[model samples]
Target chain A: MATGNISHGRILSIQSHVAYGYVGGKAAVFPLQCLGYDVDVINTVNFSNHSGYGRFGGSRASAQELSQIFDIMDQNGLLYPERLLTGYVPGAEATEAVTALAQRLRHRSPKLIYLLDPVLGDSGRLYVSPDVVPIYKNALHLATIITPNWFEVEVLTDTKITDAVSLRQATQVLHQTYHVPHVVISSIPLKSWLLDLLPAHLHPASASASTSEHLACIASSRQGSSSTVYATCFPCLPGYFSGVGDLFSALVLAHFTDEPTTEGETSLSRAVSQAVSKTHAMLVLTHEAAAALPEDERTVTDEELDVREPIRKIRRMRGRELRLIQGQDIIRGTQPIEFRRLQAWDTFWDA
Target chain B: MATGNISHGRILSIQSHVAYGYVGGKAAVFPLQCLGYDVDVINTVNFSNHSGYGRFGGSRASAQELSQIFDIMDQNGLLYPERLLTGYVPGAEATEAVTALAQRLRHRSPKLIYLLDPVLGDSGRLYVSPDVVPIYKNALHLATIITPNWFEVEVLTDTKITDAVSLRQATQVLHQTYHVPHVVISSIPLKSWLLDLLPAHLHPASASASTSEHLACIASSRQGSSSTVYATCFPCLPGYFSGVGDLFSALVLAHFTDEPTTEGETSLSRAVSQAVSKTHAMLVLTHEAAAALPEDERTVTDEELDVREPIRKIRRMRGRELRLIQGQDIIRGTQPIEFRRLQAWDTFWDA
Candidate 1:
């Protein structure tokens, strides 16, 4: 199971690609490369920009196209990667293709660390085709780790997460039922009532001031009958960001792979803490960069205002793109900001 | 015309992408991003591995598809990149599309820096569609800078460069006749006779040991009637390397854009010197990595021996892939190897 250096190992990242802005592979690939990974990217959909823009152009790579790429790599002895990262597959057939590919990769290298970011949708909606839900659900067992936002957790587990208890219940389903070795719920926006349900130590420092403003991320590792969970919380920045989740998943893969042999709470905590801290730093930079843009570039158009659109009103979504290029130093670990540390929250989940 | 920082500027990079290996955009994009440019990539071809692998999988992005991407970017106001880089377009139609895109970009940003790498062929053979030659020729006037290998210069200017004088004559055709302000003949294999034809200072030190063992790159910049030229020479390493030319072109774009205002010999000299030096360092690392592979991985197959195949004889192409992931520090300029320096060779070109 030990590869001498994880950086020397290759990562097969199947994700969407956009020419204009960061999302999917465009967001994830550079950061992984910055952290020293030879990333082999399979672009599921190549577009002009992420769909957050009111308009976008380009086509999705069909399931057949995905198989064609896989066949060629197989022929050339290039199909095996030490790590597999799948994000943002747009349809059922594509999602199935990704799952099959993951199975093949895992079969070839039993030690493969498959980090599946189940990008079904966000904000209580399923942006992906409904048919893909079962496909992702079936694929969970193949993953070494899964990074799902709370909405995705609810969708996959078929549970309503209203409080700490229900949230842990859903996580338990993923761990005990599905047999996912580790699960990292990427983000959780806390409400006052939900914050109060948790023990006081589990609360984000900012939750005392305004609970709704705090975002917390939970990481759990399952070992036999019991599971270990940890949480990190930070004040949420107000802005639209396209690839923060993709970046977070990529960084987690990097850190987790760096400590590949260690698979329990400590490894998960360190990986989640570093990823959360780095993502927060990038988001803060993105928000500030948007604020620094010229008034004209940062203004909402009358059409957007008329529709009362959230995306367009946030400065045409132009000012809101992730500032990955400017934050290269941070990604390279040269100028890292250790903004937040993960705190053990096993008690909250147990209670 | 004044962009606050070149790094903050967006670069529209059109190239090929291989899923399993580094070549085209896979090779160029990460290095450029490491250098801190927000590179928006339009992949002209997406393949499983580079063509050097003898077998490949995937499809070329069509000219119409390229146009569709451009239209969407245009509609979204994402087309006005401060820098435009064109490389390794596989067809006449795609090359024409790239030229049109470059024209549109320059039309929008009159001060845009367009670095065009006419990736037609290498080693006296045309790897791309032969019909693409004229399109690249027609597209030359739109380029702010062009990086062409010696073979490409012969094809473009319709001149045989047997000696330094003929080489300069061909460079003059690109500069004065074609209105290309900056021309970099990326690599020159100096024969003993050709080396003698040049002034002594222009010769690489390794030239004295074995003239054929050294490689040199020439950079030239034109202003009105006169053009200034600089040359850097280094010992050639033994290896079958893919994407070395692509990497060279990308580094030139990064350094030249970093010094955009002064677009003459000094800037061109610094750009080419840094590019050549950095490329040399990466190549040295690549060669060492290939040599360090397991003996079985580095052995030539009997079938290849029967055919006397140059590619297979060099070891499995696996050993030869660019170590870009491990060389991230070098790409980031954090661990630079200033292996060579550019020398003013105006006299050699003048003679």
Candidate 2:
């Protein structure tokens, strides 16, 4: 791997953009730019805000528009980005368009590191059209890395990830059957029973694992026949936060390189650990900021908001948006918080 | 003025966004984020790249689309941005939409600082339709600050600015007749004849004025009957750089505050000096990066590119795009370079 490419990278990121809040490209673009990458974005949906509020205004980019943008990019030699990131395309046609775009980008730059965040749905609900599922599945083989949350893991692999064992099995299916070189399950809700499913060495201490306060991130890297898995557990912040997954995937691209620096560490695991650490710190900052908002302006947790009243829902959602701008110091690595729990989970993925 | 507002400003910026290079919002957004401002953007034009390349792809957002976005923002209570920045709206209808949006924003947040960049054209060319001129002229009174280059100054105030004296006169018209609170003539071409028109104290040294190596930036702030103008002169690099105005206006918003810090210094003047200094440094860094590219990859000066062949034009344009990502240190103010010479030109505006 070339050191120059890792330090000074160029990425063409296709994602949704909200005019008033941070989500999708809004969440992803700035951190990458701060980390010293030229990120060129094609906005998949131009909304006033994310739909987590139950209502948003703005239209999605059509398949034809995507093709037109790509055509000009190709004509102008703007397709030579070192990385390509795709997230949150709204429709089936647009999904297919993005898949075709990924294929074209890979064809142009054979060494292109394509990080596909298969943004189908999360938390057992499908936010995108059902047709987007097969499209994302078919495009999986083209990805250098795929960052999927627990719900997406179940949706993509046709398996239920109720515990650690099932989650590991689904990730292995992505590595072996789909031929994805790397897989990062972005988050898993670690219930007490689910914690028991992990191997003894990988388990959290009894005092730390008391409630459902901890969530885990698992990463796997496959090089030829050998594959390695690593997991890190961190305490989850209360309340709803949009764009954590987008930010995590973006950080993975920024920190990812196949060159391992020290013993007992793979580059994929190290990158995942760094991304997870930064994301956790940023979320803590965001949570604190949201909590500090005046009582009248504060948002209720996701469980508390009434879904029927869109106006009330949108108002509450505003206070819950991620404070990416405020967390610039952490995103740029000036304030590094190392959440160290990256341990080998190779036992779960026996050859 | 509230310190909390200054440290955590929220801005609604309506500008162009391109998928490939740094221009318009692409040039402005990241730096503001690095400076700790939450910037929400409405992309006026979505293009493959800036039009400097002669031919590019993508469509401009329509007047209806802008209205739709604003309607949703208003409905969702996302309308209370602390700052509103507008640049490069394509047609008359869209310009009106932006003007209406500005009016609504000001009505909601009376303390809102509106920075309007009348992006009419450069040099002597009119890239936008002539119809956009009257709409911009009528909307000048709504801006707290208007940053326009020499050509836009002429087009907006209907006065030809051949030298510093005429430039000052045109800016006064914007301050007096149009009722704009502040004006920043982003650039002035410093020809030897133009140098002769300046008051003695504002003139550069004869040795330094031997050639037209320098350009001038003049800023004026009006408070009732009293208005002060300040001038700073810096050497101009020999290349066509895009988005200097957008970046300048964005920085001015980030730095500007009405409260005077010390004797003989207005907050407006201090902000202008910092913005001009940072812009100059970033341009120097960008020019050096362009020069260091491989010989075949290097672009010729704007005058050297043949307009008849667009393929050659775009190929050359590739190397000339701003290196905003690489210059993140300077943009984020981690590497500060203070370029002094913000002399008070109050003599030009004596009662």
Candidate 3:
């Protein structure tokens, strides 16, 4: 799966495009472009804003429309995309169209790297149609890299990820069952052992540990070799962000594709570390901007106001969209933040 | 029309989105976001590539689809866009739909600043359908700022723009006839006097003068006051470049809406000068990149190969798409380019 020294390659990104907020295509395109990749976006849905706002408006692109767009590209002999990225397709029909498009593109460019972010839902829920899950389960075999949240990993593998051991088992099932070469589980809830891997000074006190600490783990397996998994954890901001996963996946893709494979720091660990650091920096900036909003502007509904959890209260506040544009410097890597990497371990769960 | 010191306002951008090339929405969205504005984009057409390739693929968004998308936004109460920008609508139906959308948006928010880039054609040609012209003429009255090339100004005002005098007359007619307040006639063909207005060292000799030198002129007519026009000239790089106009309009809108009106530098002259400088910088970058391509990659058709004109020869060479993402630092204003402003003058042509 390793392609050597290809820079400035074209990326075919299929996702949703929102007019008012950062999510899906809106979240991914700008950051990838900032990293100097030519991104071709096929929007699965066009929405007025991210649904996290409690209100959103837009229409989904029909499967026929999607096919028509692809036909034009096919006719023009422009089908070779070095990487194909699938984000948020709304329904079963769009998902099928995207899968067919990806298969066709893969057939044309055999070395093409496909990264699928299985955006079904998060936090024990499914936002997309149930029919879409089967499509993703089948499409996982075609993906070179699969980025899913812990919940999505659980859903896809039909496993309960209660602890670190179960998480490892789920990843093993993903690799063995779907033949996915690389799996990156983003925003995974950190456990005690994972926290112990970090330097003592960076780790939060166990007494005050909350659900806000997260680790993003990247696992890769090769034939005739043991699977190796590396993880990096950063303190998650105390709120729900609409597009953090989208942004993180884009940054990882850009780093993994743009950097020379021969470089020592171009390993998966280093790329994940950089991606986590940037995502953390952006989150910090967005949180700060939200905190600075006028009290009236940050007002929440009565139901939200009664919530005791600080994270919940923060999530319900109005005008809490990610400050992506305001934090462009961080995306450009002009402003740097530190991220701590955990020790790499061999897969211990049975395959 | 004057709104002061509003930072990070939202912009509603209606334009064409191309998958493979930087033009229309593809060109405008990133730069505006880089400038720290929340941009909501409604793509008028989705194409495989810009038409400059001599052959391309794509489909236009139907009026019903546009209305459906807008309906969602309207239902969600997300209609207030600080600035509304229209670019590259392909047909009469889309034009009418956008006009109605703009009217509804303006009625809801009277302070909305509408900037219309009448992308009819260039170099004395009409690339869009003839029916679009009448639509544009009617829509012009609704725009606060109208950016048109000299050719478009001629078409809209029904007058030929031969000299600086006629150019002023054309703009005057635009203001009085259409009631547009701020008329920016981008890419006006420069005469000798206008060329003399540029710094002497930057000027080319009279013997080699062609239709390549263009002045970007901004004309403003406020009530009970004389019309004032300011112009700046940059040597237009040879060859057809797509999306320069779109990029220019986005930059202008960003500067106008983001910068503090009270600051001396935030005047219309400063905005136009900065926009032109950035556009020129990008053009220079693109031309250099095109020139550096391998000779085999620069091969052209037999008809193009026989052309003796250097500009024509350069235009015919293959692989000439704007290197926008590579040159994004200029858009971010990290690499500064200097542009000189010509003296301001009152309209001198008789109506």
Candidate 4:
């Protein structure tokens, strides 16, 4: 309210709500709000915690319930949100409902930017129902910005990404096939040569050469202009983080919505850069906290690190959650953005 | 995570979550998170917006579903949250489930603090089901802190609060009969005589003589010591505002949990003072925003300002929501707390 003339953008975020841990809406909403967006979250699933803990509690909201909520919003004449973000829709029905909602919202508000986070799975598999892939692919046309990790990209485009060239090709194919103006691949595995080509400071000494690190790439293409792709590689974190993608999507959207595309600065690239920098800072904070845990609580065995669980074993062993609250200052910009921007094309594999 | 020695406290908040408005958990969770607490929220109902717009859509979680969620948390060994909060339980079954959950959590962790916001009604009428009142009364013993408005106090204690003396007596009865150590009467209507007893500067020039204003009071009793009661008065902003109570409860809990009851500062009074100050600032922001709207959008007919609707007409008239995100800096303490602590007893009506 202190902001007199400056209008805070409204974001309607549809995602999961975990009572305990940070995932989906729980992870996304806070950061967006911290960044000064008026965020309205529609949780597709309400659980006691993220399911990564082997056992969890809560219920997935029925599509009918979602429709009812949407209807109510419509009745209240609250249909036109500045932006709409969809994350972690549980099943085919939820996916259909969300897609329909997005399309209707897009029709209602032409400027309503849709940021779709395709949350199928990480690694080379599908954690969600097989039916969800086609639904996501179909929903891609509605999204102004699409954020998918490597595995989701593969699932959506039906292409394997073995190296940098293939990753660029896949991203290109996504733009050509789906007409998505902005594509942000959240975590693409980096090859050894690519890692060696980068600056040494990017990789911490603790990061071993044997393990693959990840690069988050953002690609934007206009109709007549050549496309610009920007990418940044971060040190391979020791643990699996469940809500990092959600956090990234939220931050990117926040930046994009907060600052419009100007002649001097490409808003998409700037947004991605800011988001990656913030996420890297948050991960460093998370890693430091995990490393500081008592020895008895520090190490998690391979068996306990179940692939089925959404969170990583190391996180469970350390604090069993993302350190969102503790690292909030970073999210709010009180802590400076420490991660530097790499030359946009220099890190691009195709270049 | 950056705070090496400080451990962020955890709060399990059970409340309603509106997708498009600030009320219940939607109003509570972000402020607590902004203050650096790791908050887990269980939403009782997921409405599109607050019901104050004459219509709303959402489904309330059944008791069975609530039990299932609790069972999952218990199975995962996550039942020992440092604090538990309950707000806006839609039905008796949900109330019973929450009470049981609180008792079980309290048993698991004896140090667990339960802050119960008895969100039954305000301004002398019951908005919720009548059955919820008895359930709330039965559950009062399980709470460490109970925040209720004047109407709720009267309903719970079966007494009329004509003046400050009666209000104190009612709070004492709550402590004696229900064993609640902390009783915070959120809003007590002040009489004209009481207003004259206060310093003139506390009341703004716009606050007319005929219109009644409210004061927020906190009464705390220790086992062997006499009770300490504190009160602060503010000009009543024109228009109805929902979620103010939920926001107050959250800020109080955040402050109380953040700072222990040390010798130099009474944590209860400090928490109440801070919460009152923050709420007043937010209301001021809300009033400014509402007043800035075009005249056509400014006025809400008296009939439209229904007491059954939890939020204010001004909010609905302008943005159709509370200005929670706009005034978030106050919630995060970046903005200075402006309202000072009034002479605790000068504002007392009986004096």
CA-lDDT, candidates in order:
0.82, 0.82, 0.74, 0.76
Point to the candidate with the largest lDDT. Answer: 1
- Model 2 segments beyond 4 Å from truth? A1-7, A163-165, A205-208, A223-226, A299-309, B1-7, B163-165, B199-201, B205-211, B223-226, B301-309
Highest TM-score: which candidate? 2
Question: A1-351 in candidate 2: lDDT tens per residue?
Answer: 111212367899999999988899999999888787889999988888888877677778899999999988988888888999988998999899999999988887779999999998888898888878989999999899999998998999999987656766787789888999999989888777657656667665556445488887888888676578888777878777899999999999988875645876788888888898889888887777778877756746444556655666676678888888777767777665666547787675542
Residue A159 alpha-carbon offset, candidate 4, angstroms: 0.9
Model 2's TM-score against the true structure: 0.94
Chain B TM-score for each model? Answer: 0.92, 0.92, 0.86, 0.87
Instruction: Provide the lowest-lDDT 10-residue window in model 2 chain A.
Output: A1-10
- Report how closely model 1 matches the true complex, as a DockQ value: 0.54
Ranked by lDDT, top first: 1, 2, 4, 3
Interface RMSD of 4: 3.6
Per-residue lDDT value at A225 in model 1: 79
Predicted complex 3: CAPRI docking category: acceptable
Q: Write candidate 1's Cα lDDT for B1-351 as tens digits.
A: 111223656788999999977789988898888777899999998888888777777888999999999998887777888888989887889888888988888777779999999998888888887788889889999999999998999999999888767877898899988899999999989776667765677777653468788887888889677787788778888756899999989999888845453433488888887789888888888888888888866764466472565445434777888888877667666674765778777576545
In terms of lDDT, model 3 sits at 0.74
- CAPRI band for model 4: medium
Q: How close is candidate 1 to the true structure, as a TM-score?
A: 0.94
- For each candidate in turn, the interface RMSD (Å) is 4.4, 3.8, 6.8, 3.6
